[model samples]
Target: MALTIGIIGLPQSGKTTLFNSLTKAGAPIGGYATSTVQANLAVVQVPDTRVDALADIFQPQKKTYTTVEFVDVAGMGQASQAAKEKREGLSPEFLGHIRNADALAIVLRTFANDNVTHVYNTIDPNRDLDSLNAELAMTDLATVEKRIERTKKAAKSGDKKYVQEMEFLQRLQETLNELGLASDVEISAQDRVVTDELFLLTLKPRMYVLNTSEDMLGEANEVLAKIEKGEQVVPESLKGELKGIAQVALRARAEGAQVAAVSAKLEAELTELPEEEANEYLEALGLPQLGAERVIQVGYRLLNLITFLTAGEDEVRAWTVTRGAKAPEAAGKIHTDIEKGFIRAEVTHFNDFIECGSFAAATKKGVQRLEGRDYEIKDGDIAHFRFNKGK
Candidate 1:
C-alpha cells in the first residue's frame, strides 16, 4: 500500500492551506463543501543529502528520490446531534482517508485571524485536540467491535488459534475503548497475524502541529507551556506560522507521540520562491528546512523504513525498503529477474566506498565484500548484483 498521512482539522484550521504549501499545488482551501469535495493527494519527495552526495560522485544517467504521500481531507463535524459530547468525530469520508494513513499530523490553530473563522470561535488547542482524539478513538473502537464479533463466531470451530486470536483482540478492543492507540498495547507475533487487518485508525502514530503567527513564533512555546500548566491559553491575537515544530527531537524516546512547531504561512511563502531565495528566507527564520520535509522524514520513521543506495557510472539511485529486507528482496526491487536468479551480491558500504574513492579500490582495501542472498540489506549499501540474467 502507498504510504499515506491523512490531514484533517476543524473548518478553516488550515488543513488544505498546509497541504498546498507542502505540495506547492493549488488545492482548494475554504469553509464550504463546494471548495473541497475530494481529499487532495500529493507525493512529496523525501529529502536526503546522502542521495545528493551519491549523485555528485557517480554522475549517472538517472537519479531518483523516495517520496511520502499526503492526503488533505475536508473538515469534520458536520452534524449537531451526531458529535458526541461536543466533539466532532471525523466525517465518514474523511475517516476513509485517515484509516489508511501510517501516521497523522493534527494541525491545531494557535494563530489569530479575524478573516478566518475557528469552528469553535476560540484558539483553544486542548479543545481542538480533545475533539480530534475522540473522533479517532471512535473510529478504532468501531473496527474493534466488528473484529470481536467475527472472531467470536469463528472460535466455535474448536480451533485453538481462534481462542488466542480472540483473547488478543479483546485486550486490544478494551485498550482502544480506553481511547488509546494500537501501539499502546503490545502484540505478540501470534496475535499480530490475527489483528493485522483491523486497520484501526487511532492505532496510527500521531504528532501535534501548533500553527502560530509571525511575531509569536519564538513565544509559541511559552503559550504551550502555559497551556500544559493548565493555565488559560485563549488567544485574542498572536503571530507565528502554519507550523510549530514539536518540542522534541526525532530521536527522543517517546511512548505515544511527538510535537512540532512551524509557520505554514511562512513555509508556503518560501515554497513560492527559488531555492536560493528560499534558503535565504529559511536562514532569516533560523530554520533548517520547510516544515513539510520534517513531517515527511518523521512520518517515514513511523513505518520503520530506511534507504539503501546503489551507485554506478551507469545509474545512481536511492531505494526504499524495510530495514530488514534481505539481499534477494532488495535485488527484487531492481528487477524480478535478478531476484529469481540471485547468486551473490558485491556489497560495499557507501561511506567506505566513497572514502576509498572507487569500488575496485574498496574491494582491494577490504571495505567491500561478497554477500549471499541471506544477507540483509543495510542502509547506505552500495550493491552490485550477480545474477543469472541469461536465464
Candidate 2:
C-alpha cells in the first residue's frame, strides 16, 4: 500500500520546505506567514539499506522501493483568533484530503525568522500546540455530533441498532468534550463500524515534527533528547518558537507518538546541493542524517507500517503493509495471482541473508523457512513466493 500522511502546522513553520527536502520535490516556499494557500502532495521513496542488500543478492533487472505520500496542508492556525475559529476550523477541502490519510504529522516551528513572520506575532509553542490540538479536537467533535444526530434520528425509527449507536456516540461525545482522543475512547467492534466513515482526525496516529532554526538545530535536537527523557525545558525568550515543539515532542514520546526534529531551512538548502556536497555540509554541522530523512522514518513508524522484501532475479522489490499482515495478504500486495494461487513462502530474515552472503548460502545454513498461507510475515523478511500461477 502507498501510505499517506497529512502535514499540518501554522504558516511559516517551514512545513513546505521540509516537504520539499523529504520528497526531493520542489514546492513553493513562502517568504512569510500565510503565503501557502494550496496543498502540495509528493510521493517519496522509503530508503532502506535492506532493499540495497537484497538487490545485491538477486541482482534484479529492476528494483522497486516502497513509498509514502505526504500532503502539505495550509490554513491551520497558531494564532489565538484562528485557534478560536478552529472549533469550526476544517474547510471542505482540508477535510476531504485529510480524512482519507492513514496518519498525521503535526509540525511545530521552533525556528526564528524575522522576515518570515509568526502567525501569532509572538511564538509560544505550547499555545500553538493548543491551537493545533483544539483545531483537530474541534473538528473531530463536529464529526461526532453529526453522527450523533444521525444516530438519534435512526434510533427514533424504532430500530434497536441505532439506539446502541446513539449511546456509543454520546459516550464518544462526552469523552471528546473531556479532551480525550477518539482513539483512546472505548467502543465495541460493532459500534466501530458505525463510526467508520467519521474518520475522526484525532483517531489517526500522529507524529510531532519540531522545525528548528539553523543556529538552534543542535539545541532543538537536544531538546528532543530532554523531551525523551521526560524533562521539560522552555527557552524564556523563544518559548513560542520552541516550547510547543518541545511539548508536542514530549507528549508524542510519552503517548507512543513518533517524533523528530529538524531545521527545514537547513535541510532544504542541503537538498539543493549535490549528494557529496550535502554530506560534507552535514558532517561540518555534526549531524548524522538530514532532518528530513528522520522525519520520514518517524512518520513511517507512526503509521505502524512495516516493509517486506520480494527478492528474485527479475525483481528485488519492497512491499509495505500494516504490521500484522499474513502471507496471502502480503502476497496480494504484489499481485492477486500470487495470493490466489498461494503455496508456501520461502523466507529468510533479511539480516540473516545479508550476514550469510546470499539466499543460496542462507539455505545452505538452513536459515530459510517454508511458510504456509497461514504464516504471519515479519518486517524485513526476504520472501520468495512459491505459488502455482497457471500462466
Give the best candidate by lDDT: 2
Candidate with top TM-score is 2
- The lDDT per prediction is 0.72, 0.79
Q: What is the lDDT of residue 81 in candidate 2?
A: 58
Off by over 4 Å in 2: 31-37, 78-86, 177-180, 226-245
Candidate 1 structure lDDT: 0.72
TM-score of each: 0.82, 0.89
- Residue lDDT tens for model 2, 285-309: 7788888778767876777778899
Q: Report the poorest 10 consecutive residues by lDDT, candidate 2.
A: 29-38
